[model samples]
Target: MSTQNYLVISALGKDRPGIVDALSKSILEFGCNITDSRMTVLGGEFAILLMVEGNWNTLTKMEESIAGLEQQLSLTIIAKRTEQRDRSNPFLPYVVEVVSLDHPGIVHQLASFFSKRSINIEDMATTSYAAPHTGTMMFSVHMTVGIPADIHIASLRDEFMEFCDAINLDAIIEPAQR
Candidate 1:
């Protein structure tokens, strides 16, 4: 017997206790096996991104099995085949981490900077914690981005420094190894 291929499934909604139970039940009903997954609660919302393997033709059935889950949990579900091309090595991989006092427009500024350079942000996570008595908020963000091999890292670093100075935020960029 050969191993079955896999598809990726992503779901997100308000944070709740039963989201995983509901999701697992649906996956089991379609005879799909979840090989790897990452689930996290961000700002009161639960997000799950999973990699599942099953019969190639079972994609549609798997989707249907989870359709009602959206209504039951009031969540959004997205399922798609994990394309082989997307699994290949990247041309250039890099990481950018930012930490600073909580403020608006940070994401917008950083995202726009990367977008202008044709960089692709593959994954990103951000969180903020407020100090109980100090009334100061701390913000932190981590992102894995892919850039073309032709782009210059030095130039990117310089631009990021300028951005950091303007926003009074500290930023760091470094090459990410595969």
Candidate 2:
């Protein structure tokens, strides 16, 4: 007889070289296969999200191995089985992009707006880069937000436009289908 397996692990910590090496070593120690993974540095923080698979009986051992790594690297780790469902289902998946002069509170304002409306943000990637010629900072946020089928997209667009106007930034919201 064979045991079933399922799990996803994600980690985030201060950005530094060798973090990936440490994480890979830990994963190897646990003997878990990396099914799929993505890692990136955002605003001086290194973040990793990975899907791992192994026998159910070894799940705790795998988690323990990663927990050791977390302590060694001062990382925050989150692990959950694949069967666990995420709360909040915002209808259809859509992408919202905003590019504007970098300033404080941009993410807060946009996220606040969505939260107020019960929108589920699946994934968001935001970065600040220098503007060409001007050398000033510009912020770019690409968010995958969930929109309910019954929700009026036009109204959302209108509200986004108004919000963009108030913040002096350009916001674009569109349905994201793969």
Candidate 3:
């Protein structure tokens, strides 16, 4: 069997219709599979992260096309070859959610809390908006973390709650529903 090669591609450009179509069409033409992708519009810009899988030659061909694609799509494109991920540690996936008045440092504080415990944050997203009726600017965060197998869940939960309380942020940490 031929070994499959993977490439991680990130593209950013002004928001427009048909960007996804054009990108996906190019990948298909190169005989690559879009194994995973995240596409979003932030303000007036479109950003995308795609993980593509193909045989070595096809991936190389795709890489060679990036410069032209950038011109064609008016996007800044970056591609890097990567190996498939293998989890080295047995860890539980937990989802963390937080809500509070929008302010600086909430994300930083949350990151510090997890980093200090050696937990891995797999994914996260944050948003700010006006609260219903109150017209208050509110910030919310959703994160997925990998908790080491050896850590006691109850103790960690207690400590996390205490940390949130001290910071005056409402939060919850729970095992992810697979």
Candidate 4:
């Protein structure tokens, strides 16, 4: 029977134009398929996370070749075998948006609230900027969270709104469009 191996690979290095090209070259040469990937520039560094799949021997070849690529590109590369995960879940999706005066404990507070409820954050992005006209520092957070299907959305929304009001944040929690 034919078998496939899954790998989760991560790389970080100084931002440069050819980092992706160099990694893609090695991945191609090793005959592995990049199933999913996320690459971003954070500060002065380019970071990459990739999910790859291939036959056992092809993956072995990649493991051997990555060392050379790491040295040539001056990157920190890590690869680990991972089991294919079931992405389907029984949770309902919600989009949460928050805007408030910049403060240190905003993220921590939100995370604690969600953690207490057993909610799962699927993706989150946050940023800070000066508010228009006023020039006041503002923090904005946008996140997709999975709420357990058993929870009543109306009650949960009421509680969430109360929490936001207590914290002086302008927030909205709404159903996410698929």
Q: Which candidate has the top score in TM-score?
A: 3
* TM-score (all chains, Cα) for each model: 0.77, 0.77, 0.97, 0.87
Candidate scoring better on lDDT of 1 and 3: 3
- Which residues of candidate 1, in runs, are more than 4 Å off? 1-8, 71-76, 80-82, 85-89, 131-133
Give the alpha carbon lDDT tens digit for every residue of 1-178 in model 3. 5399999999999999999999999999999999999999999999999999999999999999999999998999999999888788799999999999999999999999999999999999899999999999999999999999999999999999999999999999999999
Name the lDDT value of residue 126 in candidate 4.
87
In angstroms, how far off is 38's CA in candidate 2?
Answer: 3.3
TM-score of 3: 0.97
Clashing pairs in 1: none
Candidate 1 versus the native: TM-score?
A: 0.77
The sequence of per-residue lDDT tens digits that candidate 4 reaches over residues 59-99 is: 98888777887899899999998868656669998999999
Per-candidate Cα RMSD to the true structure, in Å, reads 3.4, 3.6, 1.1, 2.1
- TM-score of predicted structure 2: 0.77
Model 3: colliding residue pairs: none
Model 4 residue 169 CA deviation in Å: 1.9
* Angstrom error at residue 18, model 1: 4.9
Q: Write the per-residue lDDT of candidate 2 for residues 111-156, one digit (tens) a residue.
A: 9989988887878888989999999999999999988778888998
